[model samples]
Target: MSFINFEILATSIVILCRVVIISLERLFPYNAHQSLLRKGFWNDLGMYTLVQSFVLSQIIFGFAYWLDGITELSSYGLLSSWPIWGQVLLSLVVHDFYIYWFHRWQHHNRYLWRTHEAHHSTEDVDWLSGPRSHSLEILINQTVEFAPLILLGCAPETIAIKGMLDAVWGMYIHSNINIRSGVLQYVINGPEMHRWHHAIDHEAHNMNFGTKFAIWDWIFGTAFFPSGRKPVGYGLGDENFPENYFKQHAWAFRRFRKK
Candidate 1:
C-alpha cells in the first residue's frame, strides 16, 4: 500500500475504535447514567477530531516529507528489516516512552505549559477532549515526539504505524467511559489514570503526564493514586479563558508576554 493509503487506513481504524468503544460504553451503561451517549457528544467528537486531526496531519506530514529527504528516512524501511509485528511493538514502546517525558516537559516548562493549558481547559473528559489542543501546541508536541523515531532510523511506515497506535490509545484513555482496568492502570495509562490527570485538583494538575504508559510516571515518582477517590472535577483553576479556540490560542501568548 502507498504511504497515503496506509495513513488513511490507520486513521480510519483509530476513529472506528474510538467510536465503537465509546458507543458501547454508552449503550451498555457500566456506570448507571450512560453519560457517554448524551446529546452533543458526537458533535463534539466530529468537530474536535476533524478540525484538529486535519490540521495536525497536514503539518506533521509536511515535516515528515522534509525529514525523509535530509535523512532518506522511511519508517517502512526500518520495519521491513525486522519481523512485521516486532517492528510495530518496538515502535509503540519507544514512542510511548518518548511521549512520557515530552509530556512532562510541557508541564515543567512555563512556555510550553502555556500552549498545553488549552487542553486542560475543558471542564469535562470525553473522547473528543483528546483532540481539543492548540494547533501550535499540537505541532510542537507531535514534532518533538516523532523526532526520536526519525533520528533512530525508523522507516516512515513504522513511524506512521506508531502514530496510529498513539492516536487510538490517546483517544481511548481520554474517553468518558467508566471502564476500569484495575492493576493494569499502573502499567499502562488507561481512562481511570488519565481522567485523574485531567482532574481539577491541584495535586492532580501536573501528575500522570505520560501519554500511553504509566511506567515512566512510576519510575519518576510523579505518579499519584488516592484510594477510593476520583477527581472531584476537571480543568484548570483561576485562569478562566474564553472557549473560542482562537481566543484560547491567543490567551496562551498573552500569558507568555506577561511572564
Candidate 2:
C-alpha cells in the first residue's frame, strides 16, 4: 500500500478508537473536571495537530526518501518477508522502547525540557492534550524514532500501523476520562497512570516517563504508583510562560538567556 493510503487508514482507525474511548468515559463515572477544552488547549491542539502534522510529515517523508538513496532502508521489503502479525508485534515493542528513552531524555535534559514543557503547560489533561507538543520537539522526536524503523527495513504499512496504535494510545492515556485497570496499572501506561505523570508535584512530574509500556519506568526506577492519592495540580510550577502558541515556540529558544 502507498503512504497516502496507509495514512488515511491509520488515521481513521485512531479516530474511531478515540470516539469509542470518549463514549465509554462518559458512561462510566470518574474525574471529568480536568478537560482540554479549557484555556490554551485548543490553541496548542490546532497548531500541533492541524498545522504541525502537515509540515512535519512532509519534512520527515522527504528526509526519509533522501536517506533511502544512501542506505538500504526501505519500508517495503521488511513487511514482505515476515508474517504480518509478527511484524506488528515487533514494531510495537521496539517503538515503545525507543519512545521510552526519548521521553525520559526530554524531561532530564534542560534543552529538550524547554521544548517539551509546552505539553505540560496545560493545567488540564484530556484526549486533545496529547497533541499539545512543541513543533521542534515533534520534529526531533519523530525523526529519531522513525530512523530506527526505517533502517530496520520495516514496511511502510507496518510503520503506519504502529504509528496509529501509538496515536490512539497517546490520546487515550492523556484524556480526562478516568478509567481504572486495578493491578494492570502497574504494567501498562493508562489514563490513571499517565495523569499522575503530568501532576505539578515534583515527584509526579518526574516519574512515569514511559509512553506505552510501564516496563521501562519500572526498569529505570522512574515509575511511581501511589495507592490512593491523585495529583493535587497539573503543569509547571514556577515557569512564567506565555499562553500564545507562537510565544511558546519562541520561549523554547529563550531558555539560553537563563544560563
Name the candidate that leads on lDDT: 2
Query: What C-alpha root-mean-square deviation, in Å, does candidate 1 show against the real structure?
Result: 3.4
C-alpha lDDT (0 to 100) for residue 56 of candidate 1 = 81
Give the clashing pairs for model 2.
Answer: 75-155, 126-175
lDDT by residue (1-259, candidate 2, tens digit) is 7789878989899889888876766666246564425778668667777787778878976787678758766645655587656887877777678878878889899888987998898787777778888888788877776665676666677778777876898888887775778777777888777888888877786789887888788888988888777788787764688888888888888836644
Which residue runs does candidate 1 get wrong by more than 4 Å? 1-8, 27-47, 73-80, 147-157, 256-259
- Quote the lDDT for 74 in model 1: 59
Each model's C-alpha lDDT? Answer: 0.73, 0.77
The candidate scoring highest on TM-score is 2
**lDDT of model 1 at position 131:** 79
Q: Candidate 1 clashing pairs?
A: 74-155, 74-156, 75-155, 75-156, 75-157, 75-158, 76-155, 76-156, 76-157
